[model samples]
Target: MAATVVQLTESKKQIQHTHQVFDTQKQAFRNNPMPSLLERKENLNRLKRALLANKDRLVDAIDRDFTCRSKDESLIAEIMPSIQGINYTLKHLSGWMKPSKRHVSILFQPASNKVSYQPKGVVGVIVPWNYPLYLAVGPLVASLAAGNRTMIKMSEFTPHTSALFKEIIDSIFAEDLVSVITGEADVAADFSERPFDHLLFTGSTSVGKLVMSAAARNLTPVTLELGGKSPAIISPDVPMADAAERIAFGKAFNAGQTCVAPDYVLCPTDRIQAFVDDFRARFTEMYPGLKDNNDYTAIINERQYERLQSYLEDALAKGAELIELNTANENMKDSTRKLPLTLVLNTTPDMKVMQDEIFGPILPVVGYNSLDEAIHYINDRARPLALYFFGYDKDQQQHVVNNTHSGGMCINDSLMHVAQDDLPFGGVGDSGMGHYHGKEGFLTFSHHRAIFAKQKFNSGKLVYAPYGKAVHKLVYKLFIR
Candidate 1:
């Protein structure tokens, strides 16, 4: 009973601290409503330097959190992206910050119009556990570039990484300028309820809904980076080796915990077996063994491990074929939470693996008779965050592009679309909404305030009070048509 009371007291303290930090950031934003371009650039540079200086520590922290996360995977997926995103923002910030000149209609003579992209003060970023460093820093880069004070809520599931990240952030930034909050689910709920000017969440669709609901209380605009079942379609003409290699890398990276990972594959019915064989071969080549392998990553935790296991069990019970890509055939049951890349064949719409976003290294291959059938299958489901189409034929590629709806696409590739700093990253419909990355990231956290200046002439006054004046008639005659 005393321990429960102590836990409750600690929770209260954490909630209080979150509220205090939020208020501090809000006031700080008010004080410096518009940060200068040089200031923004310096902020980005500082972030970049901090990340580089502590790269090894950050990688180690994530490894400890996941138990068996590969150092190279953390470096590639998390640290590299975070640094790249900051550098991208720094390079493009000046152009993005300039007041955009807009057309001044001839009807309104002597008036100049333009749009000023002003920061939306105090942005809230709720980072997910899968790639904590990148997700947190990606949104932070944008928010800082747009001159907004930011507070990040790191995931509790990645406690070591989250704690280390908070320490690093605190060392570099004042609480008023930037802060990182870490706690359990209740603390996250409280953080979401705070009245941030804009909130960006990267997590599951269900949690996104709850975050949106909380933001609604403050009428806070949100950019939700939610996940769904992203699909990779293999064209009938594409070589199985090519398609399988790319798809294998996409699903195998970070053990397929990526939001944009290929959740399933849509392959030609005739080449399904060939694609399967090639994919297995490619994956084994990448990791040769699972247990005690430094290059291979384990599932994040036991809960997630069991969840993926249950998915396999459920799929098997429903008569789906399960192929475990355990090349060395080592018993992983008694080892760490490492799961071999498992493939689910002959999947139906009713299977649990097909229905949910398989965030682990579980790939389900669904056979399609024709390109039209594959396109129709994708169209029937919720629009995914990303769709990968593998084909060399220009007509077939364009056909798929025109018929499909997805946040992003890759032709003859997978997962590389996200690495391109020039492209905007997001989702559509059930997958997610709103975009961030490059200029879109800056815009998402900014409010484009329209400005109109009239120096000498007041043209609008001509039609102001009198109902039937000559000038008013002339104005009406000119514009009414």
Candidate 2:
């Protein structure tokens, strides 16, 4: 009973703090509605400097959070992409800031039309545990580039990294401009309920729904970067070596915790054995050791480790064939929490691994007879965040591009498309909605308001409100079509 009371008290306090911070930012935004281009550039540069300055610290902090997070993976996935995004936004910001001119119709001659991009005040960013630094800063880059005050809610799961980021942000930005909050699920719930101009969430689809529901009270616009069963299809034309090597890289990186990681692979039934052998060989070459190796990252924690174990167990119990790809061939029954990348064959729809998002180093390989069967298999499921195809045929590539539904599609690639500075990264349907990363990101956080200008002479006087008039009828007859 006392614990319950304490929990309630804590929840109330977190709610109060969120409201107080939001109010401060709201008033600050009202004082200076539109930030100048120079000011926005300055902000983006400042953030970039901070991130680069703390690159080592971020790596260390994330290592502590994940226990055995690979330094190279952290640098490649988190720091590099963040710097790239900031640079991309900086290069294109000036042109994006300009007012886009629109042609005025003949009926509205003597008037000019253009769209001015305006910042939405006080954006709320909710960062998930996996890749905390990158996720937080990705939205921050977009929101800051668009000239909006931002408040970030760090995931409670990553306590070490969250605390480090809080310190970094506090030292760099004032409370009115930007701030970070650290708390548990109650705090996240409270943070979402606050009325911000825009809210972006990156996590599971279930939690995204709750976040959207809370934001709906204020009609807050949202950009959801949710995850689902993203698939990598191995076309019949591609060799097993080429296809498996690429798929192995995407799934093995960060132990397959990435939102856009290849969750499963669809292979031709005749070539399943070749695909399995090639994938195992590729993963072994990438990391010669699995347990107690810095090159191979461990699961984030015991809970996640056990959850993955359950998936493996369930797959086995349901008669799915398992091939553990531990190159070292070490005993994995210890408490280190490092899991070998395993491929589960003969996966059925009823199996738990097939039913849930395997955010681990587990790949389910399903056999398909033809391209139509493979396309139907994908379409039958919830829309994914990313779809990868390993083929060089232009006609088949175009067919897959037109027939499939996903947030993004990669041809002859796996996860590199999200790194492109020119492309818009987002999901379509159940995987996620909305995009960020480059111009689309800036536009996502900014409002493109339309403005129409007219001459001093009132042309509308000809159509003033009254009973039917000759000028009104003649004008309508001339222009209504």
Candidate 3:
């Protein structure tokens, strides 16, 4: 934590510098392949200090990058989870790094079995624009704690925040230990193609495929944190007022840019209107002014803004009822990409709003006659990253938890599961492939090598190659049988 942090300038040699940093880190890891516990703790400590020191700076940078990212949202979503991840890793490193003992059979009585957790040389992390700092630092927390070197690739869309990230990282780590690569598509492609020991990607499902392909050439293992159409199911037993507010909070936070944000709601056919009314009321209570409120976050860029607008337009044209949740009733058609929350009802399965992952503050309420039908509706689509069930009945909640399959699920809640360090945060199947939080993250970046050690009394010599007649038959009869 006391090391002098390097001051970095933007590199003009995008691809070349990437290769150079990779080689440099590989050599550094080779020089000290197994960093001591003290060394690893110090690395984590430095990151903690860096995050605490630059808390405000990171908030400002993201606000500039996005038209107006809410300060509280940045603090809660980006900074808070990041600091928690670091703290959780530091708390449990002692036991997690210890070699675990395993059972050995009587035939191997003279020997003992144990699995050692070793570092995976260098790790490559590709950060997406949506949650740049959290994605980068979350993996960094795991990689460094597991005693591996790391290199990060920032998204091109958020150049300002990416550059600021590069600056902050330079202050804490040498490029050889942790380097940040910032450039357009070409640089990102080259960065992913590097032969790192382990690679982790947090982005869309399509780009995850490309990264996995690139990692395949070198036989490098990858952990992809991709996104899908995550859904929320409200049981008929629950009150619409409570269910709607929780769903509204999750959708409105970050303007629904979160990967695990509830994509759509499945309500009892009789209560669909009530759910819509409750959601609108809660949203209005939260943000009284839509256009000028600083607490309300804006979309990241013009392209994303237009994409959301198109979805709204398409839904309206396809006979879907549109209700804009603009509590203030102000005109938000200005240049600022702050979109008011909108609800689309009577949406068909064919509409783009229902087909795509809505990464905006638009919620589509799909009505279902039976709870089984709602679960079936979700299962019919691609597996989602997260699922939520809002109901007071314990048996119904348990049934939902048992029947549905997703990366993670919350009973009567949305978006809180990801914040828990004790629980792993990741996706399943199409949503994502691996996990990275707490011990799971540590294990993902580590290689558990099995070792069997024997004493001077070598009992296994009884079955040596010279004993192919009597001893071999006895061994087969004893152990193999």
On lDDT, the leading prediction is: 1
Candidate lDDT values, in order: 0.92, 0.91, 0.90
Candidate 3 residue lDDT tens string, 1-481 = 2221211223337888898899999999999999988899999999999899999999999989987889999999899999989888888999999999999999888789999999999999999998878888999999999999999999998888899889988989988898888987778888889998999999899999999999999999999999999899999879889999999999999999999999999999999889988988898999999787889989999999999999999999999999999866798887499988899999997899998889999989999998889988988888999999999999888888888899999888899999999898889999989898999999999999999999799988777787668989988998775
TM-score of each: 0.99, 0.97, 0.96
- Candidate 3: clashing pairs of residues: none
Number of clashes found in candidate 1? 0
Question: Using lDDT as the measure, what is the rank order of every candidate, best first?
Answer: 1, 2, 3
Q: Which stretches of candidate 3 lie over 4 Å from their true place?
A: 1-12, 466-468
Candidate 1 lDDT trough over 10 residues, lowest sum: 457-466
Indicate the TM-score of model 1: 0.99
Descending-TM-score candidate ranking: 1, 2, 3
Top candidate, metric TM-score? 1
Error of 1 at 139 (Å): 0.5
Worst 10 residues of 3 by lDDT: 1-10
Measured over all alpha carbons after superposition, the RMSD of each candidate to the real structure, in angstroms, is: 1.0, 1.5, 4.6
